[model samples]
Target: MSSTELQDRNVAWFTERPDDSQLSADARHLLESYSRIPADDVVEHVIKVRNQAWTIFPYPCIGQFRFLDMSMKYTKEYPELLERLAKGQRLLDMACCFGQEIRQLVADGAPPENIFGCDLREEYVELGYQLFRDHDRLKSRFLTADIFDESSPLVKLQGTFDVVYTGSFFHLFDYANQVKVSTAVAKLLRPEKGSMILGRQIGAVNAATHDHKTNPTGKMYRHNPGSFQEMWKKIGEDLGVSFSVDATLHELARDHFRFHTDDTRRIHFVIRRE
Candidate 1:
């Protein structure tokens, strides 16, 4: 079959909702956006990232449940921080994929006015803004900005935030860029015990460095959790602040490849300076 045919097939499969009850308006819109994209732009390589599941299954988002499930599992590691966020603490959700975690923060009681988010993809950020329009308590705003762009809007957001948070974006940069981002994140802090979250693929025996080739478009840089830890350790040393791995959120990433076992991947982190 042609790419268009394959695209149509995938669209047909994804159109079948898991359940009307499981569907949110934003979720529906996401699915619709997926359908609207041309088959030529829908690269086969992306399917490989999730182990062909997006092509084989009817799911709207990859690892949707697993991401939240892991977050709940590692609750203890971030209790103090999460609790503080729950109590109207200001937050900046950098490179927030779909803003679900931001929603969770609002649900946990973070003030809406205090939450700010940005993404390189405008559609994702736009979706987030529309999704949270009804909630006055979660007046979270989303903007379009490339984190790597030195003059991006994010770099000029007037003033620093109370807590600058980034979950999955760290692993998408090389070690040097990660360090740059760490400094940028630090600068975004209000100079009052600021903290950020770095979640990356980690292993005991392996040192996670930059993995720049996994993405098909050659636009993303990735790292394992260990690399993130090391980056922060160096940053902490330079900044004269103590830093440590707050928790290792394991079984958090799922790869359906037959060669990998259940203990394979994780979304672990280092929480410091708060």
Candidate 2:
């Protein structure tokens, strides 16, 4: 899709270049600490990498450097995830643009071999290597697949992961598509107590489908905590399993941006199979 068309979905696409002040401190830390970009050149490095990824896909997250946020750090489950990864338990990062969180896991002492990252586009994965400057060091495997496709590589890896992390994902789909993705995620995780799916997404006080600017005919779901739980519960029932959903919707200091509105809230969720 044209940049002009993508802009409507989120105002950041093709907008005027934002100043360095717009980059978050956490993102800066990752660039300096994990990527080893000199503190002085971090902004320049981020800009160079972001520019390359945008040419591949004008995702709002890419334009805003939201991918660098390492969302799992803020969740209550963060410490637990770190513990799980350190012990050789498997984890998968879905829609892990630039593989930022995977790098964070490595930086935090998790074994790279225990973690996996996947996205729909492989270009983002290539750019991720550039962004982190870790092509030679990081051993985490990155896969590219469509979550909704039954024949997709991600879908084929059912029951292999213990923790599935999706950063700024799920909100990109309509209700039906969201259900499909959730079902796929359910299967992707080990079907035992404590196997979990967790992530951050664009949420709303009111749950509903909204217009998708990148795809004119497409719809994206903005869910509240209740709606999100209901979705997984319905899926669990159909799959003959049970789930424990812990979700909360709240605003963040970062929400005051071109990509969000008053209705926007951060949905932090963890769904564990029981």
lDDT of 2 by residue, 86-133 (tens): 888999999888898888888888899999999999999999999889
Clashing pairs in 1: 112-137, 112-138, 112-139, 171-222, 172-221, 173-221, 201-224, 201-225
**What TM-score, to 2 decimals, does candidate 2 have?**
0.92
Give the alpha carbon lDDT tens digit for every residue of 1-274 in model 1: 3434433433422322233323434333432342333334323322333333333322223322222222422455456656666666667777675576666555555566677777776655544444334333346787778766788887776346656666656555555666877766766666555455544443323444322322223233333455556767788778776755564545432332222334445455556565
* Candidate whose lDDT is highest: 2
In Å, residue 240's CA in model 1 sits off its true spot by: 4.8
**Candidate 1 lDDT for residue 176:** 68
The whole-model lDDT of each prediction reads: 0.51, 0.81
TM-score of 1: 0.62
Q: Candidate 2: minimum summed lDDT over ten consecutive residues — where? A: 7-16
